[model samples]
Target: MAGCGAGEPGDVRLADGGTFRQVLGLEIPNFHPYRDQVAAVYSTLLYDSLVNVTPENKVVSGLAGKWSATTTSAEFTLRDDVTCSDGTPLRAADVANALNHQRDPALAPAAAAALATVPSFTADADDVTRTVKIRMAAPYSFIVRLLGTRPIVCPKGIAAPADFEKVSAGTGPYVLTGYTSGGPYRLEVRKGYHWGPDGARTDEPGVPAAIVLSVVPTPATAANQLIAGDVDAFYTPDPDSVRAPGPEVTKVEVPAVTGMASFNQRPGRVTGDPLVRRALLAAVDPGQAAAVATGGKGRPARGVMAPAAFCSGDTVSANRPAHDTAEAARLLDQAGWVPGADGVRVRDGKRLRLKIVTFATSAQLRATAEFLAGEWKKLGADAVVEEVTVMAFITVTQQSGDWELALGAGVTGSLPSDAVPFFSGPIPPRGRNAGAIDNAEYLRLIGQASALPDEASCPVWQQAEAALVKRADVVAVAETTAIWFARKTRFQVAADTTIVPTSIRLIRG
Candidate 1:
């Protein structure tokens, strides 16, 4: 509300009944759902998964009309009415193929972790009972929820995986007609799309007929476009950058996201030293960081997940870094780091200089990095910020030699299993454990939680999460809320996700 200003309502309709324009903050570098978060958004447009989570956080059926799951296995029944945009009817083999494609060993451990619950899949080709049976290595209570987030590809696309860049073969409500990396993307609605989650139909009143994703990397630019009536909607984690939209615009907050800094704790890295890590964590203030990052439009994070998240709790409270420059200085001094003539800490002739790499996804992240650098400087540590492309950022996370810290965005699901890979998997460059964090206690707690039945594992999961923060593996910055502006358009963003075009509709004026 502080940043939004009044603006005139723009005409929402195109020549057709369902076409609308929107702006994306980053250029989609890839279309693979397992590749990156940006690609997941595009995947949602071109492909519907076996199921989906509603805005209310309810899990509903998608391609699979209904499903049943056990701890070690799950079965999905293919809906008879679903078909690819090319008119290929949904089949058990296609579902199996899609699952297998995701399970490919070539993918990064973090990306492939989406199917961790499923070790193998079997297709039941019976024409009367089309189903796919998934076998898990261990009992997982949230297998359905995990599979529901995966975007399914047709068998043809799976066979010719290279063609995904040029085309998409999915059974979603929209067809990808045109796409250019870092450019505009075009999608047309399926004429008779009726297989949306929970009985969603294409003819629904608010469902957009078509969507045009115009690439605009800057939040300020996107907000201007929306205010000028060139774009109907724009989603940004830093709403303050958008300034203010007029009274005609509707603003919504996407909850359960966090913007934090992960420390690379590899053996030789500066952050690997527990004393230095604790000192660094103690020097900064999350409340001030969130205020600077959001321009006072955000809140400091109390934990890794949002309050509504099933595993959400104040686990980070015990480890929440306190703002004490003196304590930070003391810790560094005790660790053999002494201030040089220039006031920068030096030990054994090596200066306490560190670099924090960031991607160009959020302007606030850049500002927050600068803020942290300034704070660190007060304690005699020289921290610098480096901005790069999303692809480069992903690459840097895997190659963690040069960076001591990295500023990034993270999201969590309703279940603890959804976050396991990020905090507990193999070390950096090997899995989603970007920090190369190897906490035996944390890993032990996760294992304990994994073996427990659903709803009963929340406490252990919370303990595991708290342990990571307590060790300063990641500095909790802010509880992220996606501030989205809609003008002459109405849309629903899933509880843990940003806007998916299929759920958008024009405001009838």
Candidate 2:
């Protein structure tokens, strides 16, 4: 094994009647649906949405038994027998509360941003049927996809912000049992749970009775645990490097995770100058840097979303930047920046410099920042890397003047409309537009695409994507694969998201 860990997760079960344990490098800040990745994973188990999208982009029913829509509104008919983990029957009012919570302008920035396309929600029910109607401010074509991302929580959570992370009152298969700040977060499976999308059931054979999430902190250590059979599964930086040389373990490639670097293009900033942004892009090859960052395990990115995404196409390929250090220097010269004696570009007593804010928790992203900094140096630009916590990274990106460049990764959705907040809108603390992009044509095209049906929105979406690539608001670096090493688990991970708890099943030895 070239880069494999030294130990293995022995074929053994914990005392709690088959608890599936997984490792995470960072702690989830909150268990709220939109708080973080861990929260999203947890929400998948603890909550159910009105609908779910299949890997093939098909709309499927989750909590909702059936649904229909028009240009300005969508109607959902809920299952009569659905119940939360707490044994309370799920009500249409709960659905209304969840949707309104996500779109509430006064709270939850990320969630609010995601649901910005929807303006209001109302719930009505009779003795035979519970129905919820969602009213869109406009004709949002991807309303189903947008609703799929939002998991409906109990009405209690709507008023209590802390309850989202602390309480377990969702109509899903799992209930949050306990959580600690550092490690060993736990969830216990609900019994007799028959209301699952695509006919999934809780009593299915090999379904773990409980799931335990632990913080491993080190990738190699977690990999070693997987190989030693001390852990059932774990994510690896390079799947090829971690699997044992036998049939006991297997590797799964997860998709739709993309690494990117966004420029803070606000006025009065160095990156705001289009020439500087272009020169920085011209100086380094994102593909090469991504290779080094992921240790050659990732696919070079083609666009904002992975190619597998429904909206991805040749528009991304058509706008990729070429690597040319000479052109980089020439661009700097044309922009009135001249190289001084030390070979660093200077203009009006200010050096041609940039600071890229990256996460300290991710070794790959940090390495990417370092590699890009080296490449910028070769082109007579000074690039400084600033490593910070995930919480700090979010704060820096949302605050103006706090960052020049940001290197990070984002999860993709089944629909392209899911990305509206990041690329459009006003800059925070007003909106989720961290890059401060104000392209009127880009905004117009996105609006046009979002208003049409999915079948008719392809060309408009492509043109809108072209605007992003041409403007270089956020430069896509790699379509990073989530390399999962499994010991005795059998499951399929979605191309759009890494974790799929509903699909996990233990392998019989």
Candidate 3:
């Protein structure tokens, strides 16, 4: 323990060569970035993107040393020294084809977020120049940020993606050497590796030589391990579950829009009507639901994008409907849906019914769904709750298109453009826009914003977010400051709590 070194003066030195242990909390079903959007969870551990963006929209070097972008096209010159985990030199063609493979929506359904920004795009690699050129389907304001962060699968994994279910392929500092279903994942540091964000190197003092990831089911259990010095770090929305952490522990609160009332706007659904959507949003007390979701440790939500987003503004405060059940009753009554004998509204002989669904395994998420249902029931609606696994979430929300509202279904990211695909693109099966939101004004503004350069497009982008909130199409109630606890380790994370793999440093006594 005495071999470890610390960053600041007056602190003990932390160790240089030890395996950093962590309770992943989240599931890692696959490592193939194209197969699922969740693939980005552990992506930094085994893959490196072309470039990285800071909280202020500052573009930094990543796998690509240099790059340039415009409204409809961009190019990245890969680092010549980069190599795959298998020890082979990474080729521009291999990664370019990887980008092109996503052009087919069918092949990259889960990772369709890239295509969401631009409906179509083409990628070509120039071996001679070590350059990868991309042409977007339409004008895109944030092309660099989107394509830059996407992990590139090496040719080996790209050729046989199914193998990725048990293996990984990329040019990251760490290589996946051990894995199993419902077991700890093991990764070893790649010696002589570089190309990390902001010039992070593996051999740096205090950096771990290896990492061990285990899926701990409960927040209390994981937090206990962290405090006991048995684990390095863990994050939890319900921080109250953890006993008071001592001074040795570092707790970072990441503010993010975590509570949302996502209505299914598919044709024939009760939430399809904007009036009903507004009524539903007004009936539920955002403050109360948010409290239940985060164990009374949450603040009011600000907007669709987190505060870390460069263009994020207070869109919700100005656009959100005030909580008023009487207003809710009046809206439904005006729509000719009068309350029946049993208090359930009846519209043309149809009983008003609603179902809330959640894919989260946390008890807090399920409790939030129940809380929303109770509020809807008071509005004379037959409200029920349904819980589903993450694997089945897309199937229900996208393919089956059942249910009325989604509890844990809101989108969260660091850019205004990050919300476009989930709100505007092709609806489910074809895309992840399960809500089937058809806001012409929002869609039009997105087009205008996309054609402009970064900072110059903030006004139009903010207007687009207002359009969604004003319609009650996407109502966010609360912001949960997810707590990230660390002991003998140090690292940085995004607003949504995604860890910076290269930033991790394991400390010793």
What are the RMSD figures for all models against the true structure?
3.8, 4.4, 3.2
Go through the candidates in order and give the clash count of each.
10, 11, 7
Worst window of 10 by summed lDDT in candidate 3: 1-10
**Candidate 3 clashing pairs?**
1-509, 4-13, 4-14, 4-15, 5-13, 5-14, 6-14
136-184: candidate 2 lDDT, tens digit per residue: 7667666666664578877666667676675576788888888888767
Report RMSD for candidate 2: 4.4
In order, what lDDT does every prediction score? 0.72, 0.72, 0.79
lDDT of 3 by residue, 195-267 (tens): 8886778988777888888888678889788778888788776576667877788766666666566789998
lDDT of 3 at 194: 75
TM-score of 2: 0.88
The numbered model that scores best in TM-score is 3
Model 1, position 484: C-alpha lDDT score: 78
lDDT of 2: 0.72
Output the better candidate (1/3) by lDDT. 3
Lowest lDDT sum, 10 consecutive residues, model 1, at 1-10
Off by more than 4 A, model 1: 1-16, 34-37, 107-128, 256-258, 306-308, 359-363, 389-392, 412-415, 426-430
Best by lDDT: 3
Off by over 4 Å in 2: 1-17, 34-38, 105-110, 117-128, 236-247, 256-258, 294-299, 361-363, 388-392, 399-401
